[model samples]
Target chain A: NAGVIQTPRHKVTGKGQEATLWCEPISGHSAVFWYRQTIVQGLEFLTYFRNQAPIDDSGMPKERFSAQMPNQSHSTLKIQSTQPQDSAVYLCASSIGLGEDTQYFGPGTRLLVL
Target chain B: QQQVRQSPQSLTVWEGETAILNCSYENSAFDYFPWYQQFPGEGPALLIAIRSVSDKKEDGRFTIFFNKREKKLSLHITDSQPGDSATYFCAANQGGSAKLIFGEGTKLTVSS
Candidate 1:
């Protein structure tokens, strides 16, 4: 198994620009999760999708952050009007079917907003 | 507020020695706790986990001691090695919830 695959190992965007990160979950896994990791905030949950449906996004920033899982195989996280403070490693993880299952993470996209 | 927390921002241990990493949670609803280990530039990987029903969980060299009443847990790595150097995160999730709350992490370094 290739495990989870995330595109653009690193991303650089200027202020006000938009950044879209991609994640392809492991085969047969029904749950996908997005998280942001920073020096100050540690690892923070951004959103989650189960079976291609958004289940929870309480941790997402109300305005510019958005995530979607169009199918069981992949999910995406988009950040609009990216600011310098938005720089962080965006990680994607997947599990068999959620509900206390083990989550396997991808390499992550290191986003650096300039 | 941080729902999950880890102690000792960083630690150093000698090879073959036992290394202990501490964690605590504020939410009593949290029933599943997992410890993730991350090397520089890599995403965290699950190293060990324990449910609220169990006080202790062991796997090879790693063991987790959980205290349900105190809302606390600790990861013990026996016979530590230099390769064990990494940041360990304590994460928690309530049953049936898809989201996982993570702690700030504890960086451990094992010297040979």
Candidate 2:
């Protein structure tokens, strides 16, 4: 199996520019999640989707962040007007269903906003 | 609010020694606990996991000790090796929720 796949392993954007990160979950997995990792914040949950429906996005910043999973295969996280504070590794993970299932993760997209 | 807390932001241990990392969660509904290990420039991978129903789960040199009442857990790496140096994360899933509450990672360094 290919595990999870993330595109543009690394990204660099000028301040105020927009960035979009992509993720392809393991086949047959029904749940996908987005998380941000930084030295200070550790790992913060951003959002999650189950069966192509957003289940929770309370962790996402209201104004600049949005996520979508149009189909079972892939998901995207978009950041608008990106700031230096948004420079961090964005990780995507997937599992068979949820809960106790082991979440397999992708290598993650490293976004560096300058 | 931070729902999960981890101790000792970093630790250094001698080779062949045991490294113990602690974690505590605030939510009682968290029934699934998993520990993830990540090396620099790589994504986190499941190291070991334990359900609330069990107090301990062991795989090779890694073990997870979980406490339900105190809402605490610990990951113990026995016979640590330099290869084991990485950031360790403790996470919890509450009531079948897809989201995982993660503790600030603890970086472990095993030196010869």
Candidate 3:
């Protein structure tokens, strides 16, 4: 298996610009999760989707962040008008399902908002 | 409040030594515990995990000793090697919650 594939491992964006991160999860997986990782805050859950349906997004910032899983194979996290504080490594993971199952993660996309 | 917490912000141990990383949770509902290892420039990967049904779970050289009464768990890495050095994270999930609550990672360095 190819595991999870993420695009543009590194991204640089000007403050106030929009940034979109992509994730292609492992085949046959049904659950996709998006998280943000930083040295100061560690890993913070952003949103999740199961079988192309959004399951929960309580962790997402109220204003600028949004996520979508149009299909079972991939998901995307988009940050609009990104700020310096939005800079972090955005990670995507997938699992067979919830409850006691292991979630496999992708390498993550490092976003630098300058 | 942080539901899950990990101790010893960072730890350093010599090769061939045993490095123990501790974690605690405040939620009684959390039944699944997982330890993830992250290398620099890479996302975290599942290292080991345990369920509330068991007090101890061992896989290879990494073992998880969980205390249900105390709501604590520890990951012991035996025969630590330089390659084992990375940031280790403790995460918890409840029976229904799909997302994991992660603790501030504990950075480990194994010196050869």
Candidate achieving the largest lDDT? 3
Ranking by DockQ: 3, 1, 2
Worst 10-residue lDDT window for candidate 1 chain B reads: B93-102
DockQ of every model listed?
A: 0.89, 0.88, 0.93
Q: In candidate 1, which residue pairs get closer than 3 Å at backbone N, Cα or C atoms, i.e. clash?
A: none
**Candidate 3 global Cα RMSD:** 0.7
DockQ of 2: 0.88
Error of 1 at B41 (Å): 1.4
What root-mean-square deviation over C-alphas does model 1 reach?
0.8
Top-down lDDT ranking:
3, 2, 1
lDDT of candidate 2 over B36-112, digit per residue (tens): 99999889999898989999999999999988989999999999999999999999988757788899989999999
Worst 10 residues of 3 chain A by lDDT: A96-105
Model-by-model lDDT, in order? 0.93, 0.94, 0.95
Whose DockQ is greatest here? Answer: 3
Give the C-alpha lDDT of model 2.
0.94
> What range of 10 consecutive residues in model 3 chain B has the weakest lDDT sum?
B38-47
Docking class of 3: high
Per-chain TM-score of chain B, candidate 3? Answer: 0.99
By lDDT, is 1 or 3 better?
Answer: 3
Interface RMSD of each: 0.7, 0.9, 0.6
True contacts kept of each: 0.88, 0.93, 0.95
